[model samples]
Target: MACPLKNPLFFLLFMFLPFPTTAQTYRNISLGSSFNALQDNNSSLLSPSGEFAFGFREIAKDGFLLAIWFDKIPNQTIVWSANGDNLVPKGSKVELTIDGEFMLNGKRIRNTEFVGIGVAYASMLDTGNFVLANRNSSIVWESFSYPTDTILPSQTLNQNGILYARYTATNYSTGRFLLSLQPDGNLVLATTRFPQITPNYVYWSVKNPNIGFRFIFNESGFMYVTSKNESLLSTISSNTVSMQDFYQRATLEYDGVFRHYVYPKSTSSSAQRWPKDWSTSSSPFVPPNICTSFMESTGGGACGLNSFCTIEDQGPTCQCPNGYSFIDPEDERRGCKQNFAPQSCGETSKEETDVFQFQELNNANCWGGDYALFEGVPED
Candidate 1:
């Protein structure tokens, strides 16, 4: 009934956050004890909270440029792009000067203006957005606008215009993913090569105004949507859970899937209310494996769909479920094997030993197993 992601206490918590310290003199940027604002070199930097920082980075193969990152949170998510396409060359000299602009290895360039409105110095607000401000204290840029993979509540996914591009899968150099609002109000993700409408990949949607907006991602990697208005939360039909509300947050997952989630701010911590209660009408879809977690590779390195891999879990240990199975016992990237075995029911005897117990598990496909029930024994 209550909103979970919007922490009312966030305002007081950010007031005492540590500031960043660096050689470059900043007019408005604050430094923290444990951050490097600029990543490539230590000369420029920010703190850990993703509040404020600056540094040089190389984009593509040809350009080297000075960059800034929010150092306020543990994720240190980069919300802005100073020079997305334009980059400076690697190994070439450039230094961010004290007045606000960086000098190309001490050589002043024509474009010397460094400050923008709405951008702030590592100030975490009640909203999760970390804003960076200029000397006048106006937000020039924010972490919410140029999102890498995740989006927050109150953030609009525009359909009329091309809002985002897929940076490289791992390199972040810009891949082919496009996230935009559709003319019909549904949000979509498509490759530049494929422009046709595809239903399998539609990320999120907004059906009506009555549903209050809340999308949240959990620590376990599940995203959910919920209504913020208490009244609407009760009246909303069960089928609307899968329906994307007007206010929704989606992630352009690394595995090339656009997963939409409800954005709800916690009233206490940075956590959000999640595992969205799905709609009764709309069909719920399962998220891709990549969105669920990150896979670590051994000496063999980065495996593809064809490579075989195994995941160790508490329940089944290593066996894949009903719909899928193991490819190679030794490899994980070759992907999974499909189980064509048709599902059928076998008659059970009426004896006490034959009365089977029914069990429902979250995210589990319910493989083969035997069940036992007792009159008074407590179930775990």
Candidate 2:
């Protein structure tokens, strides 16, 4: 059976593609192009094939973020974003000026080359890359070089390239976890203190003996690291899906898992080999088990403080311990707070003896380190 996504008109071709296409049919957004954050029907610059879009997205009412997303998808899933921590108001605008400067409301931005030829025009490529080119039509600046939490197919992360998870599923601010390809030629996943770039603890890592250069998610949907000679060093994920028939993205999720996901382009709900939604069919997810694997002694463990972690199908689930309630009900990863006042053992007054009772919790393990170790058993 043929896939519906194989039909170009069903997914790619539009009657009015808007911009003038180049020789390769890729649309080059000319200078003097501007998009107001007010978000109308024609606010974005679309890729030639209509597979991706580059524009401002409304994250909340009256709040917008400059973002790139899958254009044809029903939900328009965002792949990369700028200003997640600092969302702009309705009046903001993104434009390429007449003098060849990429400006976002009077501030120079997304200029990858500091000393090279100035920006002449921008193009949103079918590969989901938003690029700025010289007058000679050579690409000088691109979005692939500055990825957020996700990396699309054909994208490569060089040494020191890092992806920080969003604060939460919906909140795109920087989060507690990060995946980095270190300068020492090692790819590692670690927990980091919020608002701090320093790593708290490394939970997952793969070292290369011959020096790893780039971590690539190729067009075939395989993710791997290669040496300087382009020789295969290590396979991060060997799962191969048809990149032609589906949109692929490997994201370091908010839950601290680097997962590979594919969204089928068929538009038909009845799929034989893939699910109708974003499917994690053959993903070689990192850490394998985060609940038991993560051991960040400095801050909270994988599940935060005053909570115990259990693995769920989605990811690690954090549960507040008895006599403790979560500090924030909306976000469990923020940790829990004590429900009752604390009291030292045998410190109750004579009149309060009946009211004061020890809350005996079985298996009260001292995880995340707060107390000193003893050589012998304590006296009862």
Candidate 3:
């Protein structure tokens, strides 16, 4: 049984009581006070687009890395990495701390002290530069400075020193390989202690892209070329079309593979095709990936341990010359061996000595010998 009153004091008190206010959580890339306060938290990073947010995301089985690209751009083109290979997997208690450090399992990383535990943010600017800045607006790092594989229009491949890596077939570990661009504009790759090019320096390049440019490193570390219009957004031109305007860009793959990609500016109005008029052939076997594999296998048609196999019309070969026979034809890794037997002085009879004339073959797999003289042609 409850007592009822016409003027209810309980109702009045309830109405006047203050309600609890929940804290605001911001994730968009806006340029107002909301953006300022968000950075003040020291735990969020912005994506290149204001529409998409970036910080920490648990994707399938992969770990977390400082990634910035298009959140809604179908494919996540991770342009930069704070930690590319060093990924801490999901389900692990990890957070960007307020002191600009990343913390995992209570282990503090004070070096990243600006951002609080589990906190780091990125923002997109009109200039296309995604920057990692602090609350004071001081930039800690930016995507424009460090390039992974692509070189945008405004970016320059710095006039830096030697850049080379190993040739350990499948492994990324530096092997006996080198791909370096010399100050004289020559780009050469060789299998030696250091990168060295000879007098036949047929390969060299300059930085002269007439318009816009984009480069990428595939999952396999194969570098590719892509083009965009300087004035137009989302207009990707063909690698071949851009070369017509006397513009050239060279990319070296992680495997020390060199590719001369050309683009012509006049063909920008139409749909662009990759490599344009340029194509890859095995004849001269300019493709390092193809030639290198052949050389490694010593001409064996089959692939070798931790190595890719290929066939080529020129360059190194496993087959022996006509006058030579293989020491072990079954062993492709052993390469070829000459058949000439060294005899003791005056040990062989004069009749045992025989010489067969040889003819030169342009794409000959094995060396036979050189012809002495022409039958009917006059001497030079």
- For each candidate in turn, the TM-score is 0.38, 0.84, 0.37
For residues 103-180, what per-residue lDDT tens digits would candidate 2 score against the true structure? 777777744437134667788888999888887888787889888899999999999899999988888888888998
Q: Is candidate 1 or candidate 3 better by TM-score?
A: 1
lDDT of each: 0.36, 0.73, 0.33
Give the TM-score (vs. native) of candidate 2: 0.84
Error of 3 at 338 (Å): 22
lDDT of 3 by residue, 1-380 (tens): 00111221111000011111222223323211111112122222443333233333333244454433333333433333333335445433433334444444455432344434222343454233555465566666555555433233333333232333322222222333344333443333443321231221122333324322433322221243333332321211223222224223333334334443333233454424433442232111124333322222122221222122233322223344455554544433233444567543355665554543455634323211221111333333
lDDT of 1 by residue, 1-380 (tens): 00011111111001213223343333434422222224444434443432444555545555554444434333333433445444556555443233433345445433334442222243333234545555566665455554544554445333342334434433443443455545543334443321221222332343423343433333332334345442222111122222132123344533344544433222323222342231111222222222222222211111222222222221101234345555765433224465564333445433543444454433322111121112233333
Range of the 10 consecutive residues with the lowest summed lDDT in candidate 1: 1-10
Superposition error at 230 for model 3 (Å): 20
Q: Please state the error at residue 20 of candidate 2 in Å.
A: 14
Collision count for each candidate, in order: 81, 0, 41
Error of 2 at 247 (Å): 1.0
